[model samples]
Target: MPPTSPSRCRSDGVHLVLPIVERSSKEPSAHEPWYCIIFSHRLTSSPVESIQSTFSPLSGLINGIFFTVIQINTDVRSAAALLDQFYEKRRILIVSTPDISNQYYKLQNIMVQRAGCGLDLRQVTVIELLGLPPREVGRIKENRLSSEVIEELRQAMRISQAYFTMVLVDKQGMDRERYIDPVTSDELFSYIDTYMLSTEERERMENNRDHCD
Candidate 1:
């Protein structure tokens, strides 16, 4: 049979082209190798060269086919603009590191994950900027921040992607604390209650704490 043509489709401003090579029934292993290519309008013609690749030795194949996720951000906001949304509403915890596997990053994640309720009551939002050159803006118990926002944040914070740094920004959009090492959730909560929270907020937090307990 003639080789199957590549199928093309577009959705939500994203363009995807999938090329499939059928495996022979008698000699499936001998079939020609094919690639699944994805084309995004936001990306250059050759995004594959830039997109990260992960291969699994156990499966002896790429874990997933090549496809650039279309992150839809209608109105991309600057770092300051993005952070402004949380001001007077939620305290921001910005964590920047070279990789997600960093010891301090993992420790911080565990600590935050354990104190979800406390963080919520304190109106704390954690933003993780993991990996550099093309850093990924992630959210802990919230929505992911866009790359544009992350880039602006990188500039605003003057973060050194080569090392681990965690900054605590209050609801007023001011950096209140900076940590080079992992901080305990209890320590974080104590600091926020002591310095960051208003009297009314503290009272509310106390009431919420009682119910949570």
Candidate 2:
């Protein structure tokens, strides 16, 4: 296989593979660094050596980029369990659209790009589900969810893939806010502060609101 060719390994009905992203000049200003997600799901006596030998040629390339695997099992229970990992740890902001060219998605991406500090401060993980399957899943920063997982999220939220939709899931893994149109950073921050944050978090947010911008 070529150095950049994605090696596919299956686990619980999901495939973990590397992504080859082709960007265009008309695309929004989201810089995605090259990443590799390589691992074997089935445990074997020599799994480590097997994986190392398979991608040995690409070792240098892999080391040059940031990489981690996000696997999604299509089973209903597994999907829920996958999301459970984020429960009580991070708030989820899911942004989905049929395509990235949607005006609402573009605006949301720009807003999110500018509000990284605020998102980090609030422990929010932005998951962008752009484009249709069997196309590759989209990545916003380091979060690249599988198409199956994205579909699960869409179905869970009852969001139509034909339109732009944004859903905010709080730390407790509950849907707190939904928007069909683009939302501003100030609005998101205010909502989180009012409804999701604890008293201490709210006070800290008040003190650091200016820094988040």
Output the number of the lDDT-best candidate.
Answer: 2
On a 0 to 100 scale, what is the lDDT of residue 159 in model 1?
70
Q: Model 1, which residues run further than 4 Å from truth?
A: 1-75, 140-142
- lDDT of candidate model 1 versus the reference: 0.58
lDDT of 1 by residue, 47-148 (tens): 233323432211222233333221122134577766665667667788888888899889887887777656656767677888876546554323455678
Write down the worst ten-residue block by lDDT for model 2. Answer: 8-17
Off by over 4 Å in 2: 1-78, 136-140
How accurate locally, in lDDT, is each candidate? Answer: 0.58, 0.60
TM-score for each prediction?
Answer: 0.61, 0.61
Clashing pairs in 1: none
What RMSD does each model have against the real structure? 16.7, 12.6
lDDT of 2 by residue, 87-139 (tens): 76667898888888888889999999887667766767677778877884655
Q: Which residue pairs in model 2 clash with each other?
A: none
